[model samples]
Structure formats: C-alpha cells, structure tokens
Target: MTVEEIHGVRVLTVPEAGPAIRGGADALDLVAASFEQQAEFVVVPVGRLDPEFFTLSNGLAGEFLQKLVNYRLRVAIVGDISAHVAASNALRDFVRESNRRGQNWFLATPAELSDRLAGEVEAGPEA
Candidate 1:
C-alpha cells in the first residue's frame, strides 16, 4: 500500500480490485472489503475499475458508493470518463453531487485531484 496526503485527505493506492472484494460476514464484510489496507481515503483510477462498473446503475455503483459512505471513506476516481459522462444524465448528476459534497470526486488527472484536494484543505473545515 502507498499512502500520500492531498490537502487534508489521506490517499492510499492499493492493488486494483483489492478493495472491491473481500470475504467475511455481511456488513462487516462490506466494511472490511472496502478498507482492507486501512486507508482514510483512496483514489481508484478509472482503469482500475471493472468494465461492468462503467455504467452507473442503481445496483453495483450504488452499492459501492453506499459502502464508501458507510465507511466514511473518501474516494477520488481519476481518469477520462467523457464517454461515460456523456451517456447518462444520472451519472453526470451523481458525479456533480459527489464533487459538491467533497467526499467523492472525479478528476481528469492525478495532478487535478491533488490541486482540488489542496484547495479544499485550504478552504478549511467550514467549506
């Protein structure tokens, strides 16, 4: 596991798919699966996501986001998702909402993610 701080957010990079699957009990399993590496937050590169997750449905995507929120885990997905963004209004809305909440974010690049996170940290807790 690799850890770095962007603004006030601690970002951890782990092997692809490692955090997405884990075996255990139900809710505990979900939490454990989501944070096996013990990260305060994580940035999952777009390439790291499975092809099936490309479409934002009420199923997998929702479940994933729910787990992240449930665990109070902040995530920033970095990549070029122009096609995905263009395909669904709902997905666009979800992305917009996530960015606004400052919990989940979608950035074109790691540098952008770093800059935005730094700005948020400078903006202070009231933001």
Candidate 2:
C-alpha cells in the first residue's frame, strides 16, 4: 500500500499483489486503509478489481463506489476498461459520467491521470 501525491491529492494506490477486492465490504476496508495512511484518494488498478465490479447488472460497482464516495474519498480506477466498455453501452456511459463528475475518475494510465488533473486540482480540501 503506497500513497503518492498527485495534483495536490494524496492517492492511495492499492498494490496489485493483494487479494482481489471482491465486494463492498472489501471496498470499505480500503477506505479504512486510506484513512490510516492519511490519503484522500484511493487509486485502484484494474487487476485489483474483481470481474463483478465491471458487471453493472450485479450493482457491485454502484454499491462499492458509492460507499467510498459517501466517505468523502476521491477514487481513481486506473487501467484500460475499453474491453468492458465495449461489451456494455451502460458501462461506457457510466465511465463517461464518472469522469465528468470529478469526484471520481476512470483514467487509462498514471501519466494520463497526472496530465488530466494538472493545475485542475481543487483549490482546497474543504477540510
């Protein structure tokens, strides 16, 4: 577990070697981990997310992500979800909407995240 600061936000990058995040409870565990590390953003790589997370029909994505958001933690799902998006129009739409909301982001790469958020970080934490 490593938290790297990007665009003034401390991003907790979940390690790829850990157990897969299987459900909402697992997601909350991550929230706790972030708080312990004093991180404001939780960056989850695609490999860490279970396949169910990509299946919108099960609502795991909603349940899991909403829990994190409710805790006031920004989230960045980093990886290529193009294959999943290609399989479901609803997912494509969800990804588009999530990016626009700003509180959450579905970025393709670390470099892309850095570029997209550069000089665009919120001026304050509202702390």
Candidate 3:
C-alpha cells in the first residue's frame, strides 16, 4: 500500500488483492492500518473491480461501507465502474446513498478525486 496526503486526506493506492479474496476483515484491516498511520480518509484506486466486489451479495464493499459509517472514516473509490454500476440496482443505490451522505465518494479519475477533496476542504466540516 502507498499513501499520499492530498488536501489533508490520505489517498491510498491499495494492492490488487482480487475482489473474490477480499472480505470484511480485510477491509477492517486496511482501514485500521490507515487510521493507525493518521489518515483522515483513505482512497482506493482500483484498476478493475469485479461486479461482485461491489455487490451486497456477500463481499467486502458493503461491510467496508458499514464500517466506515460506524467509524466515521471517509472513503473514496476511484476508477471506472460503469459496468458494475449498470449491473446492479442495489450497488447503484449504494453509491448514490454513500455520496449523498458524504461518507463515501466514487470518481473516475485522479484529477477528479483531487478536485473533490479540495472541494470538500473548502466546504468545511458541515459539508
């Protein structure tokens, strides 16, 4: 894992552990490690995500989201997820709710991520 701080948020490039291999414990471990290192937020830029990875059909994504909400750790997933989003209504709803709640964000590029983080910083805590 590589962590770079941008606008006070830690942008993390996590290793490709394969979607099928990740679970709730693994998500917790990653979040714990990031927090231990003093990250206010963590960004995972996955190159390719299997549709199953984001599904509520038993995977780490849902668990990780719940953990993030419970712990108040902001998270963002950056990459192309058009196919996955198209595959499941539940996942689409998850993305929408996460973004609406401001707990999680999803973007397609690094520049967009930086811009969004900057916007968040400017928007302040109430945002």
TM-score of each: 0.77, 0.91, 0.80
Superposed model 2: Cα runs more than 4 Å off:
122-127
Local error of candidate 2 at 31, Å?
A: 0.9
Poorest stretch of ten by lDDT in candidate 1? 21-30
lDDT of 2 by residue, 80-101 (tens): 9999999999999999999987
The 0-to-1 C-alpha lDDT of every candidate, in the order given, reads 0.68, 0.86, 0.72
State which candidate has the highest TM-score.
2
Q: Global lDDT for candidate 3?
A: 0.72
**Residue-level lDDT tens digits of model 1 in 1-127:** 4677666566775445454432123224434544665666777677666555656663666666567777787777788988888988988998888888777788888998888877877888798
Distance from true location, Cα of 90 in model 3, Å = 2.1
- The candidate scoring highest on lDDT is 2
- Model 3 per-residue lDDT tens digits across residues 40-116: 67666655344457777885687766776666677778888888889889889888887776678887877877888
Summed over model 3, clashes come to 0
